[model samples]
Target: MLTREWATLPEFAAMALPGVPETRALQKWAISGNWSRPEWRNVYWRRRSGTCGAIEYSYQLLDRPAQLAWMQRHVVISVEDEIAAFGDDKRYADEWRMFHEASQTKQKKALEILQHLDRLHRLMEAGHTLEIAIYDVCREFGLKRTTVMNWRRRVKYVCRHHWLPFLLPGNKGATGPRAACDEQAWEFYRSDYLRAERPNHSDCYRRMVAAAEKNGWVVPSAKTMQRRINELPTAVIKMAREGRDRVKDMVPAQERDRTHLHALQAVNADGHKWDVFVKWPDGTVARPMMVAWQDLYSNMFLSWRVDRSENTDAIQLALGDLVEKWGIPQRAYLDNGRAFASKRMTGGAKTRFRFKVREGDAAGVMTILGIETIFVTPYSGQSKPIERGFRDFAQGLSKHPAFAGAYTGNNPMAKPENYGSSAVPLETFLAVISDGIKEHNSRLGRNTAVCGGVKSFRQVFEESLAQVQPRKPVAQQRHLWLRAAENLTTNKKDGSFKFLGNRYFGSFLNDHLGESIVVRFDPQDLHQDMHVYSMDGRYLGDAPIIEKTGFDTTAAAAEKKRAEKLLTKATKMRLDAEKALSPAELVALMPDLDEDGEDLVESKVVQQFRPRAVVAGSSALALDCDEEQELAREREEMAEVMQLRDYL
Candidate 1:
């Protein structure tokens, strides 16, 4: 390989390269660029020791003179790096920057030619003749037919896909390349269809064997088909085959354009489960839950609620928050799972949702919201902008030297700082989350992207969210988490997984009907979203939620604390209700309830307990209300409630 070293960074990139700025990495230098650009982005340099004993330097930024200066002074003592550009400074000025300039000219010319070709292709759709097509190409772009032909030649002709009208009569089985192909139709070489069969057996093999008897040639025996199947790509080969089925999002981070901020323009949401050092009733500390919604339009958190359990109630309430604030969004893009699907979340008996049928009251919400709740295609994340929002959220915290937040995660890759537990309460995580948002909005650079990236989107988002206070942490976030967890659990139609609140459903016992079984959920998906897999780890649908979310550490802590608090409060209430009243009066206070009612009065007296649900909700997102308290107390007095753990 040849090597060239440039005296200046620009000179280096100015050397031949297809995509300018395809990448910029360097050592021994750092940049403090203009405020107009995002900070802390691609601005450092390093020297490397290449295998060929070459010493080289790298540039982390492009187009910024400020960064260039940094690269100048920082020198590495010893190293080898791939030589950028290869040749001595020949001092070209010979002034035409050669390769770099030449490549640009070529690209521009190619694009111009491509545009004309595209125009011709479009005209073809309108049934334009070849001459007319050529004329239109020239007309649209000031270019001639031969010039257009050259341009067309430059672009590999797109083999007419989908039905190509008539096959030039009898032009069956391979055409064009196969047009002249006769009974020699079976001849084959390396292609996606037959890159195998003769793998190492070299196509050089002079075989007269008829190629899998062209299309009409039927194969005999399953064994033959099996042999062909065996010839297909192995795992490694299959993986290497470029997937033609999916469109690649080659748009670099910078290409994302920003749009105007409309109310229902775009919504981004993410669930973050924070392991907080919450103050237990016993004065100990543990983790809790947090789920938030952010407006991509203005970067404002539409609403955020935390719950000990992180249940469906939180998700529903979060939507309620959005409903109260902005009515409804035109689109609600959610991760593909229990959180967004309504079958598990439907509140009204009439509400029904189907990923397939997409109907009923649950569908009504979509209609009302004027929204199509799209689930990100499986495995294709960069699909949903919300997930990007969360990433930006975490990055904002980690990149900020000022933030001191902490969090843990089940999937090492999924964990964000705010999702884990540190030595403090969940408050710190909330503060960190809020501050990160505020700081990002306050930023004047590219990090303020609409879709969230170091690009044009940031600028548009900042300009739009100008009035909306998208910055700042929410006040009393922990309180909300506790409140929301109360009623999150419920049963879904399919009963695939548990709903958010930890609600129980019996369908899972489909086989175990009379037997008790355990259910689990993701604390992140409020709205009682859960995955129902068997103990053996087979996935069941996400329905029949146990309480809204799951019994993750956060929910457990919330439940435990709430249980103790409710018990304390209930004991006081029970004693007061019983005071000045006889045992019969106290018994009257209790319901005509159950037969083992006597224990209820005594238990309430000893422990001061309220039903688990009420307390749990209070611990989460503040579900405590006059009615809840009243009912919990009433149920407590007359109940021999065996000190049951679930509801009051």
Candidate 2:
């Protein structure tokens, strides 16, 4: 092909034209330079000489097809020869050998090399020699020629071995100067430094030095020791320095997935001591205890009670308030505290207080109400969602201006500026808590993390209540669920019942005297009326308070003395009710009795009518009626019998 027509040919279409030398000396130098072009290898008609003369080309003598064929064959041969003769330098040769050896073990590194092989291979396919290809790759990737060469060797090794190079494992950042210290020194450092109450860095360093010198080991500098301690895993540091209970503060709180729970489906109850000082009814300053039940799904405070102490009675009062307002909960999550886990709250178990119990001896409130009880792990506050609500409660309500000067800190180290300057009354404290809880429930943003959308606590709760039917206690049957009950016998004479040194009386109980019956009353309201129930759980009428014998300043002196005297009498009556029937007493109640207080002998006729059987062994005897004797007695009493139908 002609030089002018070379541009039209596919082979030379993408290449820049080669320039001619300006002088004969330059041309001669270029011809003798032995500079073979990778693209020129396809031009077989070109010729060169070792003289200061222009080279001649004769490719025009051949047709286009013949020229194209020569270009293809020679280009392929040149590329093959270049790759075969590459890596002749000693450094390149060593790298190539090492690359092959590493292919079996350094699979990860080899794979990384393969990632960049595409760009390098594309340049070589475009008629560039191996050296030019490596240089172009280095420029394209902004990598050094040596790095490019190493990568090329790795690629070739991977192609040959059909595998990649392995990667080095990651190392921990704690493998520094501290590792030089002995295990004994580490133990001393951990005990003295990484404890529930951690010591200061300088103190820990000084102690560590002393321990190291005694143990014949090198000690770490204060700065290095501090860094080492800081470098420890956050979880490890929290658990070691603050104990497992406080480790939750260091970790991110887990958002509970509560889509399955509905409002009133599950409620969590826990007691918290108000950090602020409050005055009790009897004029004493102390932190009042607050027990509250919160809905798990909506985070709404259902009910709460303020008391001087935490006990099962307080818990029941709070729970009962919720039942009265929102209906019964399906499940209750409680802490593993003594008050929450008491028999009165959780029911008696086969094992409690480290003792075996008989079946049916104890019945818990949850069991009676058919509510499931879920006790969180001991000391794990985060497990109960109410704890988070309580934190907000303390900061919002307990810190109100009304409680100014009375605000105490949540912990001993965080006392307020006006700590102990004043105190709030119990009633005022409760009022603040109640109002704060109402605001919290109605406030927006409680459902920010909820899936449906953002809403207030009350909105979510009301929506949930709309979807499912909640169990509500019947008004007439409230007595069964409102109080803890026990079975007691009524006084046979006046049908009076005594509990907690108080007497309860009912006219309907007269028929139930000497019989076991269930009595229900609130322990907190001993002076109030109580509901009476039959042994079979049938509700009787309410029993009114007959007298406030436990503690009553209104009673006169004579009345007080009489009330105290009834204690022994009530005990005697209770014991007598439990006494078993004697054989003589049973014989006295038989037929043919005399009105006078005297025992009569058995008549012959009466003996014939009454059939008797004697026992061979003991003093016991069995009684039966003889059919023949009974018929003879009826025949003799026929004349004395009157017709009841005619008299009517």
Candidate 3:
């Protein structure tokens, strides 16, 4: 066999290049040397005649030494060699598919047969008899001669490049056994098994058998039914056996990116009931509900309060603690619980769907403080980050040594052996919870996305806090969270109002007497001054508590004296101002009467007077000196009485 004059890139790189064995590197070298140029004497390029249409180059592209090296290494190429070179391209598509579809064992056997056949062909080309070559090849491969002959006959007329599938030891057209159960039996089994009731395969098969006996239909064996059930998609099985909610649980939860948020910029609030029995001060034993606010950026529990039960007051105070400690959050992620959705917290929020929202409702804490309220889906734990911390707290705090015997499991079914044996006092339980939350925030190597498994939540929060300035409420705004609001009208007398069994009054309230006003007061401390607002929600002033005192006490006497002095001083000031204008000076300031002695102003209408009729035989009588004097004195007394009445 002669050495081929032209070679593909890979062939040239392998045979001619001694140092650069890679086709890419040789191609680079050929391009740098201009070997493919038409004017180049040693080499030229042409598209190889094949489906691939790759370029091939003459051996002269290499120097004399490489040319001789290539010729020395060349061997006589056989028809098998050419077929092997183009085997990947010449193989029929269906044959390739069949080869891949064949089992691994069959594929291995086919490969072994092909190898032995190649050996047999080489021996025949070496002038050996066909029968002898076949025997030798079969013996070399540990295969029988008959098997080797059969393999050859199977691919006798097939293209050598497409013989692998033919060599595979199986009936190419065979598909396996048909379904054992007929269509009716399959339908019955499927409909019976794939039910929401989730019937067992055996029971379903028995029922199907009974139905078959009645309906005269074929009955499939239990194994066949089980196999058919197993063939159903996993999602279909889960949806049928479990409920849709369980199926929904399989969906991945939304991943929130909180890196953009800073500490106290956004926070989430949630309430968790501990799994430990806590005896309240009132001697009632129950689990304590802890409402907490957690920073979203660092997953740190900023503030929390434990209460006998979850209520609006507990949630409000917890939020107050959060705001007082960490400043106001720009956004609060809350759930639509009764406590969080109360009028005192999120009343005016448009997203609050739990209650009837009225236009006249006062602004809630969130609205008053300008914090954006984001109401999460109800009962969805994934919506609140604080819930994850609550889970950790449940595992750590509920199982603490202090709560040993008091440990009430998270659910009724998971109760411990010593469940309800004892109860931890509320104070002790709160102390333990506080310590647990502190540790939860400061624990090292938290593997949260924000913590990065190295820093604690507190450390992360502080680090971010240094970079951003969070909005903080002023001292006056504390009432927004600390106080609950109520509409109350001041007392009709002295503008005082009774609230929580205490009377509140302020001089400023006098101006709003008998008018309905919004009163914001701390429920925990009713004695404190109540923040007052008008009906339209404008802040008036604080009304201090009017403490009750004994009437006989010196303190009461002193208070009375003080009030008398104030009233007397106020009256004296008004009298002095009035006396500044004397009555005689005020009379001189009046207009002078007309010269004719008739008033300048005249009545618009006039009427005639009727004469009085005297009694018949009436006579005019004359009085002596003493009688006349008495009559004149009586007349003088009557005039004086009339003047006094006009003055009064």
Candidate 4:
């Protein structure tokens, strides 16, 4: 190529056109000195101008092919051989790739070197190089001398900044994945650092590093590992992005093994509408929420809440009730309902949402409790069997044969002039909820006689509880069933039905018991005296109203009470189920009472008391249960018989 400085634009082209040096070709030192940037090689070509100096010039990319070819044909210094002049440096982002269009040795070799440097720039990213780096390039695309020089330069920076092949993963301008990854070793860490993400990937990585220190495992420098990671396939880059999203969705909860339920494996929880009909303190005929927690192994409800709204406040209180009662559970399982489910409930909700869940007021409350919360798929109610049980029990209370009474706007707080003097709205709600749960759970299931063969929800729960803890005392059982202080009891004494016969133990006893003091007993700790609360939050004067009887607990008198009670219940059922049955059908009935005049669910009593052997193991295929389906099948068979008779 000719020197360009001394030549005009046209002469410069002419000089570049023929490779003969100015002295050799023109018999004179023609062009002046070289293009300035030696640091920018390849593009600049130099030849000794004279004894004084060498003049360097460049072939503009557009017109270089023909000139290069002429040089090669004339054997004016092998066009391919000249690129080696720079040794090992090929600039990373140089625009020299235009040389690929070159038809001759110099251009072809120049293009080849530029491409090779690009590959090395990518591989050196992770800070380590594999022998395959060069071999693969050669086998795939045939390496050239220029490409070799580029590889050697890369080898020099092999242990350079960050991972390897490149400088730090994404240049020095930004912080890595997060501030926590500041250390070079941590930067190099990948999911390989841990096998599981339970205490997820990040947690596992943290532990593995600490473990390495304790166990003396040879550790690779993180900066180098980061480089290797950068060299991974584009597919892996895609996976990183996608995996991050997956982790974000999975926050508040990490995937876990299904079989992890144990005594405290996980606590199943959900909300239920309470059945007790009492005017809420707000005078709304409200169905208070029943939030319950059931221990997986025991099936025993460890804690329950009966409140108006199942908001965060209610939920937090429910959790508090449990923790304060039975202690913390390892995990809590619930559905995707707004009330019970929150990402922050598990894995530190903020961590689960990948910090989308900020520390708000409600979240702060739950965070302080430290219980891991998990949510099931939305709408798949069956996923939360415990919640379903609560539902069944609560629903059963509303339809119970004996329950009667329409709440007549019972808001004690209606007189809010005095929050204290006003009936605590929650107090009435609590009474209804507490009584309803107990009655529902204790009542024999109507279908259980055949369907479960005497196995009601309460029965199953009790059985499971027994199996989980073979010898749980009644007190402990009560603790699980009722709650904090409701487990204790006091005895009835001196002609009065006592609280476990202990006088003045649980609640303040009105002067005498048999005379009629509203008796209170702790369903939780029957071993101790129960604390009593009046119709309000009052600690005063809970003397039960005495039955005004005239020396006779007579059959006729009992019959009349039964008749009245039944009439009351039937009337309510008629009103509530107004959509279904007729008023006359409802009024014509009364609770079936035995000879002794005790309330009884006649249908339930008849079916449940049946011998289990009669039903044995029932199945849809066999029609063994009066299991509703059995009755339905019989009705179908009868209808089929009638259908055939129509022809006759």
What is every candidate's alpha-carbon RMSD to the true fold? 30.4, 16.5, 11.9, 29.5
Worst 10 residues of 4 by lDDT: 160-169
Query: For residues 1-648, could you state the per-residue lDDT of candidate 4 as single tens digits?
Result: 222323223344464554444334332333233334566344444444563654444433212233333323332222343334433555521212223223465454444444444344433432325454455445445666554654455335332221122321123222223323334444435555322332334454556577678765555545544544545543455446555444444435443333333455467877766544545756765556677777654455666766676754456556656666555666666665555544323323543432244332123323334556666666555566576566666455444333344321224443223222222245645655567666555556424322254544456555543445322223322222122211122234522233443334222442333332222333434444443432212333322323344544465565656855876797677778876756677766756656777665656334346554645455646655568778889999999789645633
Top candidate when judged by TM-score against the true structure: 3
> Can you write out model 3's per-residue Cα lDDT over 506-585, one digit (the tens) per residue?
87876788988778887778889999987555789999988898745676656756976886798789789879878888
Better of 1 and 4 by TM-score: 1
**TM-score attained by model 1:** 0.32
Please count the clashing residue pairs in each candidate, in the order shown.
92, 8, 0, 58
Judged by whole-model lDDT over C-alpha atoms, candidate 1 comes out at 0.43
Candidate 2, 70-100: lDDT as tens digits: 3333322221232354534342343343344
Residues forming the 10-long window of minimal summed lDDT in candidate 3: 171-180
Best by lDDT: 3
- Model 3, runs deviating above 4 Å: 1-191, 223-236, 489-504, 513-515, 524-529, 544-648
> TM per model?
0.32, 0.54, 0.63, 0.26
